[model samples]
Target: MPGYSPPVSMLPSALQTRVDAVEDPVVKQLIKDIVAFYDTETPEANAQDIIKDAEVYRGLGMILPERRRADIAIKQDRLVVIVKDKVIAQGDWEMYDLVACLPVPDRPKPTWNVVIANSTGKDPASSIVLTLTDVAADKFIENAKPVSIRQALLDSLRPYVKEVYDEPVLHVTVHQGSREGVLSFLHRYIIFGYRKPLTILPLSQISNLSYTVVTRLTFNIVVVLTSGEKHEFSMISHDSYEAINQWVTDRYLEDLSLAEERRAKKQRAGPSELEAAAEEASQLPEAEDDSDEEEAEFSEESDSESGGEEEEESDNAGSEAEESDS
Candidate 1:
């Protein structure tokens, strides 16, 4: 029977020997097709290319084994996941809700997974999970420093800078726990959490912010709100504490200057034109009410006088009648 055959020159000597030994025509044809499919060179044919072809096989009602391998890279300001030069996913540091390296069952190496919260949905089911290989995981951790990561997040919120006093951010801290929580920053405000803000405290609302030295090596930060509420955060590094203090001092000076400028401007302008107009309009109603009360009192007095004259006329007529009768 005529059957598909691979070029003997294309295979190694051992493979070519085996193909020659196979007498069954159908079996030989199947082996040829498999070898050709793998060896056929397409554009940048790599593992991803293999998967794409495998998908095509499935579409044609053929069963093919599924395989996946992706590389994650920190490219400048964004984290990118690539599969054979194709970007499968890319996101800024702000897109991530949580990132950690975790071990998989029966796998010797740990896998890195990023949990991304959906902007439109708040439920856990709406979140997306991305897995990265070992090499990519190392690069991610190296670049994901508190300062750099926070800077990326702040860059996205540049529009709110003016309202937030546009003050420089001094320090950033990540909570210490098995499940690492969101990143917190000391900016014009103490903003915490990811995509959705978990806690936001205006600088003005903070009555006192200090750190207690727990030991020579570590410390805990204490934040006192204006309402006498205190929040204590432990496991702060010495360097972070120093940065926080410097930021607090700088913010204090900035606040003082801003207050003085506002006071001077108010004095120079006196009362606003709108304010003066509103005050004059308020007095008009009072004047109108007083005039109405005076008119009512005058009418009451006139009625009393008219009634007295009528009574006096009636008494005079009765006396005249009595005299005439006599």
Candidate 2:
């Protein structure tokens, strides 16, 4: 939940004030001179577009934030990531387990470049030097944003991933072209495949499994599904078939036992639970009747007090009138 600190705004405050005071529109020559001086002094200085970059930079977000940094589109229900200029809508993961991490690769926190500018001019300032440095972009998530779009973006990012397996209890092998993929075994189910299209398989769907010793150092595992479909995974060098088989069998039995235990608990709580709930509901009317009697008694006492107050006020008024007449 904690995040990085905010970046310094605009140029270093001293430099920014000087830039703002330059009301004259025709200072391109002055900017160039300042830049030339910085060029000799610090080659990284860029003198161009000082006015545009400094002033209007904040307004770019006046439009939708998605329109600017379109990396991850924050819609109401889905998450869209633009990878290599190709827009991909990831439907499988709506909310993340941890906001920063995905199932495989993690999401990068967004950052923006801060323009570091100073007067690089001599003889009453002729030019400026400007360079950029990256810092965590807190603007989108800052409290002062008008549309609360910042909150919406943060809300979409947090605390809802169906996370399992601290590390992938075991890893088989896959054909993902240099990207490491593994067959993750968890207590509940098997994350059968990995990366491209990770699939979760329960005990009901798995038909059978077998291990093959391709060689002394090489091995293979094939899992058959109820639909008669088979998927094969090759193990890394020297990984024994016995270890993989044992792990799979143990995980499967653990999941099966947990499922059966839950079912038995639910069955045991069946009829008596429903009858107890109904009996509790039936007592509500009797409780309401007692409350109603108490309210009636309270109203009668208030009415009697009101009547006494009215008589006392009348007597006081009559005495005051007699005093006025005398």
TM-score of each: 0.29, 0.34
At residue 241, candidate 1 shows an lDDT of 69
- In order, candidate lDDTs are 0.47, 0.41
lDDT of 1 by residue, 243-289 (tens): 77777777766776446655787899888889999888988844335
- Could you tell me how far off, in angstroms, the CA of residue 222 lies in candidate 1 after the best superposition? 0.7
**CA deviation > 4 Å runs, candidate 1:** 1-168, 176-179, 195-197, 257-326
What is candidate 2's lDDT per residue for 1-326, written digit by digit as tens?
01111111324687656755777756734643463343323322232222222111122121111223324433333333332333321222322221211123222543211111111101111111111122323443334334333333334443333332323445455433355555544443444332223344544566666766577777666777667877666654555456667877775576565467567888887768688899889888653358788999999999999999999999999999999999
